[model samples]
Target: MTTQQLHEQILLKKSFLCVGLDVDLTKIPEHLLETEDPIFEFNKVIIDATHDLAIAYKPNTAFYEAYGIKGWLSLQKTINYINEKYPDIFTIADAKRGDIGNTSSMYAKAFFEDLKFDSVTVAPYMGKDSVEPFLAFENKHTIMLALTSNEGAFDFQTLITNGTELYKQVLETSKTWKNSENLMYVVGATKAEYFTEIRKIVPDSFLLVPGVGAQGGSLSEVCKYGMNNKIGLLINSSRAIIYASKGTDFAEKAREEALKMQQEMEEIMSLKFKV
Candidate 1:
């Protein structure tokens, strides 16, 4: 989806919530283990229940990759279900892929061409060459890892050079690349205070924000600094919603949890941005 399309969804839904599909068989309800594809079953229920509440859904590739071929198939099914059913709800393959140009092209094909995700999270440690290949795809987004929410992010992302943080440099240098307009950055909500400075640099780019729900990052705080005229922040919730219950009624509970966040997000929109 294009930036305008994403913004329009946010405006229409009065929300910028992105539900994370980080499904784990162990954490899911025991009853689902008997299902043929427990992972996909869990995802389908969550998606069906919360589709209207969230503007986007991010399926972290690791959860599926760990289970091998069946896991991959489940991932494909999950993506296909969302694409066919909720085309306007942006789908993100949180793969964090970064490889050589040729490999990046294949990765792009797997996620964008084959699976058809609206965006994919990418690592910037390998520099512009690794990322530019993903950017080559039309209408697909490259969400670069900037200031992450992880504890170890401080080891490099915040490093100072030439009087600016390393992530700031990444953001500025990235603008010089081709098809940079399709670029978005993964700025964690845990680092909400830094977004004002980030928006000064990337006033128009979308930000795929994790660390909001389960990680204890405050939505109101993130929006205080992050929301642009287009509501550029895609705030995500994973465990807190998907694992809200561990019973047969998981989907129903998931919907309740998602709706709680969606309602909170709507209130935030009305009170803060006047949506």
Candidate 2:
């Protein structure tokens, strides 16, 4: 989806919530284990339950990769289901993939062509060549890592180089690449205060924000600083929402949790943009 389409979805839903499908088989309802594809079954329930409340669904690739071919098939089924049923909802392959240009192109194809995700998360450690290939795909977004929410982000992202932080440098440098407009960023909500500075760099780019619900990052604070006129923030809540229950009412409980966040997002937009 184009950024405009994604922004439209955000407005239509009154939400920028991205429900993370970090499905762990061990953590899911035990009853699902008996199902043919437990992972896809769990995801289908969550997506069916909370589709209207959330603007996006992000499936962290690791969860599926760990299960080998079975896991990958589940991931495929999950994305295919979303595409067929709710094409308006944005899909993100939270793969964090980046390699040589050729390799990145194949990775891009796997997610964009095969999996049909609207976007894919990428690591910036390999520089422009690695990311430009993903950007080459029209209407597909390459969400590069900027100031991530993880504790170890301080090790490099915040370090000053040439009098500018590495993450800031990454943001500025990424703008010079081919099809840079397709770029979004992964900015952690835990570093909410930094959003002001981040906005000054990429004022219009979408930010895929994690660390909100489960990580204790404040929703209001992230919006106060990170929100653009388009409300460019996809606050993700994985474990807290998806694993809200280990019983048969799991989908209902997930909807309840997502509703709480969606309502909060609606209120935030109402006050900020008067939408």
**Which candidate ranks first by TM-score, i.e. highest?**
2
The lowest-lDDT stretch of 10 consecutive residues in candidate 2 is 212-221
Please state the error at residue 247 of candidate 1 in Å. 0.9
Q: lDDT of all the models against the reference?
A: 0.91, 0.96
Q: What is the lDDT of residue 17 in candidate 2?
A: 94
lDDT of 1 by residue, 109-153 (tens): 989999999999999988888999999988899999999998998
Best by lDDT: 2
**Count of backbone collisions in candidate 1:** 0
Candidate 1 residues lying further than 4 Å off, grouped into runs, are: none
lDDT of 2 by residue, 158-259 (tens): 999989999999999999999999999999989999999999999999999999977889999999999999898899999999999999999999999999
Q: Against the true structure, what is each candidate's TM-score?
A: 0.98, 0.99
Model 2 misplaced regions, further than 4 Å: none
